[model samples]
Target: MSTSPRLKTQDTKARDAEYQALWQACDRASRKQEYLCSHHEAKRIILESACHGILDKRRGQGKIMCGTSIVSMVHLHLQRDVNSRLLAEARMSRFPSPPPNDMPCLANPVANAGNPVGYNDIPQQQQQPQRVSPMISAAEMALRNEVTSLRQDVSLLRQEHELVVSSLQILTERVAKLEGRQAVLEAYPNQGIEGRNAWMLVKPMSPRSQTQGRDEDMVNKAADF
Candidate 1:
């Protein structure tokens, strides 16, 4: 059956949309990860700068206690910022929202807690036997029997073919021997010449004359020749 072109186009479009959405989500996640890394780096640099500034101030004041306290506070703040950004990133990575409670799980048809559409309530469809005419059934059985007979006939034919091939091989050998004998006879110059002369001498005679002449004289002439 032919499919509707429009429907096929729509289906393709839907699949493309789904793929595009997935790709976009992946791109966004990647960018977010990059941004988080950059932010973390920048925060570290800022914390380092704060510590260095505090140390320089302590050197001018000749008091290390205040510098240490300020630096520790700055480090604590940087740690808090890093943790918060990590938490935000984790939350953002939770993508393509989970399936709805009403949706069924295609993978596991036998419903569990994950699938709300329970298999228990679904009615089982009983398959009915297809009706067949008695004549048709008889015809089918006859055809099957005929096919079986044909198979046997084919096997017999194969055996016959093998026998025929063997016979041909024997015949070929016999023909080869006969041809060799004929060649040897032809190769005998005297015999070939005498045979040709006899044929030439009798070939011109009429059928009746040839028969009539086949007596003592003809025999004596043949012996002489």
Candidate 2:
């Protein structure tokens, strides 16, 4: 069941080659002035494709990659020449901002007995408030609202579809029942008006006709059979 190191190395090289191809594709897409997607979008597509390939390969090999490992792989492959520190900072920003300065850090009471903490002893770094574009915020809000509306619309449409299907099913059952009655009536031609009425209910269009001649002929044939 053990895999050879040579085979492992070959697999690793093949994976790296695939990622390189994805990077090349992103670069080519960026160079195309007429490309419909933006540079970031192209990069996103390449990353997604590469991730999907990795996932499929992992499944085939019966191996599972940890979430952090997968994320690290994606970051490494996509931003090969980018600063690792910058990427770390970007990821940190995605999490909840650090607790306010007033919040106390957890420490052993016994260890801090002789050394009382003070604001003067604390380190202070100049912090700048990050500015967000109003247009981008507005667009994001609009998109969220649009997504909510679409979800509601989809639910309503699905309910309507179910209702239509149920109604058709009921109609089908009724038609089958009417057909069974018609068959019985045909076997006994002298069954009377009730049988004829059942047939009329099943085929309602017979009563509302542009041609009386055709309708009469149909009724006569039914009565004869």
Candidate 3:
């Protein structure tokens, strides 16, 4: 359940490494490009590499990758690489430079006006930009996606549980109604002596008593008429 997405089958791992190398090359080649240009080039490189494996200039042609699975894996890796790069660049841009060392109290003010302090003249140390690794970025993305999937599963389970509980409640109420009806039927004979007699008549009779009862009822009816 906790397997890393990076640790795939042996062949898959090999292909993934190859793809990473290709993307890294692309990253280096496009470093001087503008944001949108770099992004588009990265995408193009990824698609080309995924479709037609890594190219070997010495060999003069691209080796074809075997399946869509490998291509898709490379696509994800490329996206992570791009994201990590963008994040690193953003971090680098966000940090403000330390203030220039208070211009050495020059005894002579005439020296400052000749060359308005160029950035190169600043002796202050520049903060080094923190780098975010692609692997770390990939792991973070994987964890986020996993969490989202789990939340969806939990929501579905809750809905199913509620449905089951409602069904059970309906069955329980139906059973209670049936039991009440049965109790009413059971109490029918307690109404009066006439009810008791009616219940006795309603009860099942043996074959001989059935014939005798039918004959007695007909005789009584004929006499009354």
Candidate 4:
């Protein structure tokens, strides 16, 4: 799962790099076109100015002149020649054959009906029928269902285990409290027998006299024992 995201990020980076390179190439081409247009315009202006000067000189000599026409023809011929050379260079730079089409139907002879030697006409190997026991299959299905049920049971048992652990913790707290009380009782040897007798004696006494009576009886019992 984690690797999937990393792979996607790598793919995105590769695509971005390709696009950046393509855009740079396009920008370079556009700049070259602008430079060529500017150069052509400057050249045409200079040629026309020179041609006008030559025609003026010829007119001053009082002679019939075709200087402007000759200049125009020369310009047209130069332009055509330049255009032809550019076209030839472009054609040479291009691939001799067009890039192969990647359309699945055209590329895959097996899937294309237009191909006479397609896989459709080939004889396929006959597959033997697999022999299977119905009882064994039923048993496998039952086992799968049992496994699924067991997984659910295991999850429920985990929850129950947590609850049992919590209950055990509460019980342990209560046991600790009882043990502490017992430790306190054992700390005083004199209080041990008296504490037992106080619970054992069924006779009721007034609250004011209870303590005194319990102590006196405890002392008497200790002496007798």
In order, what lDDT does every prediction score?
0.54, 0.56, 0.57, 0.54
Which one wins by lDDT: 1 or 3? 3
Backbone clashes under 3 angstroms, per model: 0, 0, 0, 0
Per-residue error (Å), model 1, residue 99 = 44
- Superposition TM-score, candidate 2 onto the true structure: 0.27
Lowest lDDT sum, 10 consecutive residues, model 3, at 27-36
Say which prediction, candidate 1 or candidate 3, comes out ahead on TM-score: 3
lDDT of 4 by residue, 1-225 (tens): 366988778767755554443333322322232223445666455445544554465468764432225444436644764786588567555644444444333335667767765433333455555444333343464456556556767998999999999999999999999999999976643422356465554443444345565687887788998
lDDT of 2 by residue, 1-225 (tens): 999999898778767765554454443332333222335446556555656665566668865343323445445544652464366456555644454475456555566566665213344564565554333343464456556556767998999999999999999999999999999877653322456463443323433443345777887889999
Question: Highest TM-score, which number?
Answer: 3
Task: Return the candidate ranking by TM-score, descending.
Answer: 3, 2, 1, 4
TM-score against truth, every candidate: 0.24, 0.27, 0.32, 0.23
**Residue pairs of candidate 1 with colliding backbone atoms:** none
Candidate 2: residue 65 lDDT (0-100)? 42
Model 2, position 183: C-alpha lDDT score: 95
How much does candidate 1 score in TM-score? 0.24
lDDT of 1 at 34: 31
Where does the lowest 10-residue lDDT sum fall in candidate 4?
26-35
- Which stretches of candidate 2 lie above 4 Å from their native place? 1-136, 189-225
